[model samples]
Target: MNGDVHVDLKTDSRYAGRLQYSCSNKICTLRITDLRESDSAEYKFRFITNQPGGRFTGSPGVTLSVRGLQVQVRRSSVSYWATLMCYSSCHLPDHSSYVWYKNGQKIQRETFSSYSGNFYYPDSYSCAVKGLEGFPSPSVCGHGHSCNRVTYTDRSICAVKGSSVNISCIYNSYDTDIRSKFWFSPERSLQWQNPSQPEDLSEDSQYAGRVQVLETERGRSTLRITDLRESDSAEYHFKFTAGSFEWRSSLPGTTLTVTDPDLQVQVIRSTDYTYNQAELLCHSSCRLPDHSSYIWFKNGQKIQTETSSSYSDYFDSADSYSCALKGLEGFPSPSVCVYGQTCNRVTYTDRSICAFKGSSVDISCTYNSYYTDIRSKFWFSPERSLQWQNPSQPEDLSEDSQYAGRVQVLETERGRSTLRITDLRESDSAEYHFKFTAGSFEWRSSLPGTTLTVTDPDLQVQVIRSTVYKNYTEAELLCHSSCRLPDRPSYVWFKNGQKMESVETSSYKDQFYPRDIISCALKGHEDFPSPSVCEFNRLFQRRYNTN
Candidate 1:
């Protein structure tokens, strides 16, 4: 029927609300909705006219077939359990009977929006709607660890102001129906006689659009807060309810500490060492934990634990010296140089770095000590929460499961140390501090070590076209990545498998073609280019074919 006189099914009760018809500029349209399993049939149109023998039936009819339900797995974090939701991609009648399976065998039949279970790593599971049990969803494996009770991945987190952090926990429940899950910061635990009755943080305007709960799966949840502020600092806890049984984590919940930037002194020392003279240096860790003044001390006495972080004076082999924050004198950093032992002030080259994922990065720092015979030097992560505060590193990071064989303690000599990590993963991102010890002095640089960020470059391409002109086939291609690098690298553009000439910027303008493809990547990372996207000059097709 050449875009005219489309059949109208509004008057038929069987097709009411399921059919929609309209005619715009002689282009007739018919739409269907709320399809059911029994709606399969051959559809045709018939046209009628006022003159004799003017009625005609459509020559060919279209048959409609519907697909079954699909399943989606949701989890709070990658390291938790999952909840499977069986749903149809399109509108369909609801059904209560749903079957779940683990590795091809049926496990449960229920009438709930979500099916819950413990996530066993490497074990595959799936679900299907009752009538279509034979066509179950593709099997998926559970990621991360399995927990028998509610547990947090980390008990405390320190974030930089304006950065984001995720507070994640795993929970288990015996109740069949989970009513709610949320995160909140309560000043006192005594107030929570009924933990489930507390208000959700998302409802509070202070965190209106800035906070979100990631309930990706049953028994797992994560509270993500973005654009952090000092006001957002609090002890956060997670709560959940399944039917009548409600539970809140009693363990020390996740504590968030946000710090702003401040000015701190940098320790600079001379490499020259003499038998009769010893030098000691002290400086700010990164720029600001922002200690206003630094006090230097010698062997537990306040005599000359002076105001400056750096102090250089003649040394007797038996004399020892340490430093402390000016006002807070109780806990002084471990003494640096003592009794001709390794005593040095350590400093990092760069406090923070955002590196590409799957790439290698070097976290470098320099140190100055009185003892030329350095006893030990290594790197550690303060956020890792392990008891590594010792004269020697607690364990070789190269042997740690996360960094196994991927981490290298670079050679340290003449006041320098480095940690080189390869095959960078998102999990590798952290603030790595350096530590060293000689004879009687042990030092851990907690201030401004290297903060490494591993990011996967996700390129997003935006296609723009002229709105007013027809057959004017100029398309604007704009490329962007998920992260903003410190130095903001230039973009690399590719067209039809070849580098584009003079298209080094993120935005490029080009004339449209039927099969012309364009893609982009980071200037130095062109090997992994983004998926090529083709631009179609729809203006040309409309002007030539629609007439």
Candidate 2:
């Protein structure tokens, strides 16, 4: 049967004239010819005897794997030699010898499936079985090189901070005498340079003593970076100089994303309160290596029996759970309360916020307690805490002199609280955390909380596009902001300090002259407007003007 659908041996065109079956003295045989890769499947034989209820089907099925030979390339660790192997889906006979070809010419006869040699660029290699010389593997260039191109081994990689990563690539050039080669990140280059020069990663002070370049193979290079930081996240490109010519493709190169090593326990399956059991999986932004063990924590204590990444256990409503990597126990995940109530926990509604200057924002969160009576609660910013105060004591935001009359904490709901801040200043940009005390226990403030960023509200009119027509000049203007505004607020456009009616969007397009001045403001805050800019700026007009 083909996946649940029966295949007729006599009428099915796919198997017609190719399949044969015969039975003699209770011995059965089946045969097929010209097997295709699609024919690979688990096949079972069924038969029926003359007696009633004698129909019998095989308990297990035979698995068939039809595959063609592929040329796989592997490089030596200490030398420039590489091994080209004739690989297939199924294992070949141990006694069989293989034939190798270099540039379509017969090269050697090997007893094994692989051939080792000092392979170099511009040389192509293939392999085939000794008897089946006509079915040769597809030719693969040495070191994965093709003429004058650089191919990255991986397009993107995500790694945790403080971990090491290796970015590799294989490059080939028409001129084999390479003079210089190195890796660089365009994102980290200086913007002031007219033609941005690629700075070698090894020379960058930021990567000093932490970067190394390896060129053990003929055309392969690897950039190893250790003690990674989140700021190191960027696109990495390889560059090489062959004679006077330099090669650096304009296309995007391998992107390396360095994330924090924080772990989180994700709920795979949650049961009702009656069952009080759930399946939880430890997760991280960057994937951990295979077979990495995990450590589970319940109510601030480690659970010794659980070592796998996932755990299933009965939990009480007051119990909170967390996880961490076995070796990196210093950075454990924030504890998550089960059932979302009756636990000493605080969950912020939003993790980050961006607000305009002189505006107001509401940072809210839901808090819970295992005890009925509450002792005290307040909001604070650890970053702005006074050093003179007691290190263990958290000062309330309401009592802070900087936010004397601008901050208010409102607890309108039984379990919800919102902190509203008015007249936002740039100094207000800091992480805001909520804390509450129930009896003798206080919610953990080490867990990540909402971060607020107060940015300048002034908008700038940027020239997105410009067209120089025979009769007039048409340009598209965009009201740009340094920080994203909340709620997708509508924008008000102004021409020479006069509000432009009928156009309330963030963008405007029309025939513009050199004297036209354009600006923008938020819909409700029209009193504060962006600085007017000339329509035909020298930089923009120079880009489109045809002298």
Candidate 3:
């Protein structure tokens, strides 16, 4: 039973279909399927015989916990090597050995919680418990990359027409002497004389005055487009030449989709009819900037108090509603009749997501059909190449060999579906679209979908001089990551491969000798420690000598 509610294993909607109970002469067992985090709880078993006062209850009960595995990357900024630790949400047996995989191929000899090695870009990595190899952590990309590599900040972006958008990327080259670097688009060059040549946006007459490529940092560049138009939508790539080689322009870059400047009011009715209220949203095809403000109108009259994108109140069938940008009030959206319009669309919870490699992610969408019974639904990725299948058919993600044993589509409630992907890999980066079929109707596949970008997590050890002394130096060490850890995990420090006791914080301060080496890791993942760094480096020694 869950908190005073008798868990009806046979008839209740929540448990009846998924829970199975079996009994032997002296032993009984309960089985549950399609488990969720919410199912983590205490359970008690009770049995009653025909005789009076013969009922028996198992005291204390049994606690069940469910958890997922995650891969944590640890590295120092100065080193090329990274340490990968397979961690679980809940603690496992201390003796548990881990299995490691690189680019889906298992590493033969790795059997520890952590593995340290030189990780490079393009290749993905993951880990699992030795006995549970089927349930590995999501695949992650390496923090380091080969010299000639370019990484885009975003894989795809959707922008409203007439608005500005910036597509950025960072490039690296081994050659210190650079030749030239510029942004180009293959789509624009298709119509040019040399169809095979890359066309720089700066030289294109279409974007002459509106495009600017700004080098914000040494290796980072931003292509800012002002007063965007539908014609400006294309795949933008960055190319650079150094020494004898040029970065390939054929590699996939950022995809930009420019949409029309139109809006619609999405009506979400309240489940309870007695309330007679509905939630209204000023919906746009493409996601707007976070700082954008909206204006709401009811029956052609501006609602002064409703400036946000969403509004909720009791609705009247006679009323009509519309919305517009705060500054562009003249171009308001077409009015939508309340309770009279047919609704058929899919709204994603997030337009885009940047997730850590070797992690699980859920892409969810709420779908509505006008007036027919929904029949079938599935999720597919348009980014997947159709070289091996029918070109006209969109293959489901579940049927794709690349995502076998890693993808699941869940429909826990009506009108909502969630796509859960485990052991995420950099190759899994794509646009995922959901399709549903109703009586005589099917959701359009041309509609925009959610974009997923999988990136590798990085950890580094930062050293700061706290105090100076004649013979030695006192310094503070910090364990840093590219992103915040989920639970503010406790840290473990190591000095020359030996674990330091009683130190659990990310920061550690102490006096050190010239021969000392330092490294760190998350607590309970001691096997995968950060690359060790000499506590006393040449720079520190020089400073001491000068003093």
TM per candidate: 0.33, 0.52, 0.37
Give the count of colliding residue pairs in each prediction. Answer: 12, 0, 5
- In the range 296-364, model 3's lDDT, one tens digit per residue, is 876555788888877899876645677888766644666665565545556677767776677788999
Q: How does candidate 3 score on lDDT?
A: 0.72
lDDT of 2 by residue, 91-199 (tens): 7767778887765556755647888888777566777778877456666777655645566776567777777889999777767788989999887643212223577
Give the lDDT of residue 167 in candidate 1. 88
lDDT per residue as tens, model 1, 1-547: 2267343344333453355667789566667764545567677766544444566676687777765565576876645657877776656556557776553346755556577766665344556666754345544555433312355665456664665778898766455566887888875321233323566888777887899888788667999988887778888877767666555533356777765422222222223334444345543222223334667655434654367655666666544466656654533555545334544566577767887887788888877655555687677786565745553454456557788878887665656777899988998888887776677776654344577888867787667433313545566878876554436478888877788878788888877665667789988787767788764443444434432
Of 2 and 3, the candidate ranking higher by TM-score? 2
> Which residue pairs overlap in candidate 2's backbone?
none
Cα deviation at 504, candidate 2, in Å, is 5.0
**Candidates 1 and 3: which is better by lDDT?**
3
Task: Please state every model's RMSD to the true fold in angstroms.
Answer: 31.5, 15.8, 25.9
lDDT of 1 at 162: 61
lDDT top scorer: 2
